[model samples]
Target chain A: MDELTRARQKACAGSRLSFDEALLLYRKASLLELGQWARAAKERHSGKNVYYNINRHINLSNTCTALCPLCAFSAKQGDTRGYILSPEKVAEMISRAMQETPGLTEIHIVSSLCPDTNFSYYTDILHTVRKLLPHVHIQAFTPAEIIYFTKISGLSIKEVLQHLKDAGLSSLPGGGAEILDDSVRQIICPDKASSAEWIETMKTAHSMGIPTNSSILYGHIETTEQRLAHLFKLRAIQDETGGFGAFVSFPFYPQNTKLAELYTIKPLTAWENLKFIALSRLVLDNIDHIKAFWIMLSEEIAQLSLAFGADDLDGTVGEEKIIHAAGAKSGSIMTRKKLNDMIVQAGYIPAERDSLYNIIKQAVPS
Target chain B: MDITLDTIEDKIHSGQRLSKEDGLALYSSNDLARIGQLADSVRKKISGDYVYYNVNLHVNLTNICIGQCKFCAFGCKSSSDKAYELTKQSVLSRIAKAAEDPDMKNLHIVSGLHPDWPYEYYLDIIKTIKANFPLLHLKGFTGVEIMHFVKISGKSIETVLRELIAAGLEAMPGGGAEILDDSIRQILCPNKATSTEWLEVARTAHRLGITTNASMLYGHIETKEQRINHLLTLRALQDETGGLQTFICFPFQPKNTALEDSITRTSVWDDLKTMAISRLMLDNIHNIKAYWVMLTLPVAMLALGFGANDIDGTVGGEKIMHAAGVSSQKALSKNILIDAIREAGRIPAECDCNSKIIRTF
Candidate 1:
């Protein structure tokens, strides 16, 4: 029998695919075959259901100290485009989105590593959203953002997570774990958190009864081995903490970023994007959900990914700025009906989920 | 930048009819994303966010066929292993099972041109189905099947269609129009009705005020120009009659057929581009369906964002595409279909066979 046949057998038998076997499958297996295996794995966890949440995304501010070359959303403190949203403003946006979409269940708050903002700014934003939208789950902060908080506040990551949890932070959004390799990060986001720092921060959050999502920004300066190492690192952490909610694979969109000038880059094809999503499903056995962020991959490719081992298409994200600054063409605001329709059309049940993967409401067919 | 967007984009924005050359230009362009965007703009302007589907069941009466189409695997000779025809009782039983669902609104019936079964045998099946399920919208028979009935019954096209209508055939389905160009048709489906005959039957049905859906079997041996010509021909017919309710584009599935070894299934890229360009070319047709059974649910859902407003319906027991090696489920539940449409971020509106909105979710 061929190596691929052996790998398929191993996968069917529920044995973990080894690193070499997974790399081989990523390199040689047909797209459809890989999709079938990934779909099987996903079905074991999620069944025929794909999950999304009705959430509002609040970017607190664009001002940042670590102006990563891969980022176009961040601005200098005096930059005209940067404005720090006050706690009242964040609360008002959350209340407005809740009024518009009554079923809104989660508030996603992510922002750049701004030096001017103190730890209270982050905590107050969560506290304000929690107070105004009492029923909504507060999913905020990345490990990179946490690490920045640690530096300025002179507190441990665990202490910071505890304070934020007390202030109504529900979970982490897993944004800045972009390709967890220090070598790649040195070129793309040198001033950001190191691989160890991000993982350690997640471990701290998980130990404090806090759940967090994980992500990988690929198709940029990262090597295949580095990509696999990133997945392995995430899997190892999940095996230890068991607190990760979902794993999202973001294709590097380098349209207006400084990274575009340093490296000649091309956006990943639909085939490559689907292949990576399938691979993420096969490799990250401990991670329950694989998310296809419709903002990064156009809605079309993201919808096609439902069959290729993706069980979550994020949410009806309202007012996203990070991806838009990096040149994503799909509009940030997607209606709840539109999100539900995309899931249903892919032959799956669209379940409205919360920050902790709880199904708030199962979709009823018309 | 590979596709110069000056003329066609301007025409689309200005609401002008696209000529055949413009259609060919849209097809040949490599900028699929831009083409999809333009088509999406048109889809939004035409259908808005409403994506239409139906609760329907497809019943193929027989697989025994006289024509020897190279791209078909569903039809068989009388002596072949898969040459069984459904009896009237079996047909009734299928319809009864379909009617058990309260929302089942349409019954779609199409079949091979049986060599031995008389025209009454076909009309009786429709009569029995309609008598049993009175409220079900009976959309039955293709233009080629109509022509075959005309030949066997010794009647004119209009009379044959009228007889079927009297027997409870409410609408016609556009099948067997593989390509409008006779050169390709001569090689692909020679024994089937010619392009002129197919259009003539459709025109007759339209004149009689019988609504019908048109289809094109694309991505085969036909050229880009031939594909455009097929759309233009349908547009011309719709302009004259305005009876075509929707135009469905079926990318040729070449599996387990005579041409399986020589041809392969078209790429998703081509399937999407063709659906978009068809929307751009067929201006008069109100709905463009990306048939989920043929294109798979994922591509079909994506097509909603790319100029396709209808994903057909909750098709039960679909055999034609399954015979051509479709891996998707033959029968999709109503909930699954609705969820698929909603997940694609479009409102899923349940419609009848005539494309009238029954309910929107």
Candidate 2:
């Protein structure tokens, strides 16, 4: 039989498809067959469910010490547009959310690796959120932030996580895991956490039972193998701790980033985006979910991903700065009804879920 | 726009708790990616990168049922073509074969309400397995089956559960909770246990210290509000008892069953959304499962990202979902499961009946 047929047979037989076999499938398999296998595999677990959540995102500050070339979101401390939301300001934002959207389940807090912010400032934000909205889940900070916290606090990673957890920090987001390989990290985010540090922080978090999400930033300054290696590294860590909740892939948006000057970067094609999502499904078998971030992929492609092994459309983000800073024009905010409509239009069910993939509400297609 | 998107974003950033109305507004909003992002954020907070599974074998003791629920394709009349009950020897043999695999840590046994079999027969099945395989965790019986046993044996729900526990029943499978609304249950499964009875059984199981899983079968005649109510009810019970280990959802599959013509199968989107919403709503429940058999493996894997942290594992000889025209593999090899979990970028760990990790792959 041909390689595709052989792979299909192996998949059908419930056998583990080898890496080479997966590579072959990626290179040679028909999109239709791949989608069928992916959809079948997805349905075996999620069935008709497509999960989304409602929450606000807080990019604590744009000021940073490690201004990675791939980032357009960060600004130097004294830069004209640089500003940090103080703990009180953060509290005001969260209180307003509670007053407006009483069902708000989470507050996603992430930021650049700002050198000016001390560890206490970070913990203070957590404390403020907790004191104001004790019931809301606080999903804050990234590995990069943790590493930064360690530098400022002079504490171990474990200590930082403990303090954050004590301050009512719920969990970690999977940002700054742009690429797990050192080579890619150096090229993309050199001043940030080394791949080793990122993995170490995540490992430490998992060991502490602090669940975190995983992500890969691709489509810039990386080879196919580097991307594969990034996934493999994440898979390896997941195998070790079983702590990661979801794996999200962000295609590089070169619109106005510093890296755009050094190298010409074109956006990933729809085919490339879908293939990455599908391959992620096929390769990251140990991980339960893959997301097509609609902010990066656009609504059309994100909807198509339901068939391509992505069961999540990210969420009804009110404001997202990172990708938009990089010149993403797909608009930062989406309404819940619009998200549901997209999923329904894509012939899948639209579900409103929490930060942790819990179902908040399920929308039936009309 | 009375409530601009910015207002919601401001509220969320301020770390405010969302009310039911706010939740409805967010659920009905036009931003799909933002909702997904929020769910992803919640998923990261609760489950982390570890996607849990177990190496277990499903052994259905019998398919014969007295109640002909409209959505059930596995149940049959005693005289039906698929009606067959396993003898004690046969059941023991199946367990023996399954136990031969050293990794087989759990034996999940759910059966139809056999009219002829006495309570002793059911007890014997568990006793036989436990007697032969002491190390194996035996997770058996749904709320419906427990109710059936209670009726047949004239025993209280607690008494039946206690007896089953004594006979090696480690946990209760959260089945037959199709929808906790009596109106829908009357239409879908009138002859089965009422919503109260199912909740009572679950509460009894929890009270006896035998943790149970909970499930919802949606996409039939139930409205979205009813679905939300069902989740809220589950959350309230979980708050009271903390007896639920996981909350799983089944999309209504109408094929080769009495409801086939009346209701079509739920779309995969609906299934995914339900799982996500369940994760968001059922905050007290830690684990949410995506049953690959009913959902298909791809959707289940995608569910890992949506909100579900557990995929009910390596089901050897699964029958109920298959009876409803499920086309996925009946059983998955441990390696295949590990690979699937790894492929999804999650940690794959073998869990016992209680969702305790046995080994990480």
Candidate 2: tens digits of C-alpha lDDT, residues A287-349 = 777888988887656876876778888876766888888876577778787787777756678
Computed on alpha carbons, the lDDT of every model, listed in order, comes to 0.85, 0.81
Q: What is the lDDT of residue A56 in candidate 1?
A: 84
Chain A TM-score by candidate, in order = 0.97, 0.95
For candidate 1, the lDDT comes to 0.85
- Docking quality of model 2: it rates as incorrect
Range of the 10 consecutive residues with the lowest summed lDDT in candidate 2 chain B = B29-38
Total clashing pairs in model 1: 17
Candidate 2: list runs displaced more than 4 Å. A1-366, B1-23, B26-33
Model 2 RMSD, rounded to 1 decimal: 22.9
Query: What TM-score fits each model?
Result: 0.56, 0.54
> Least accurate stretch of 10 residues (summed lDDT) in model 2 chain A?
A30-39
- DockQ of every model listed? 0.02, 0.01
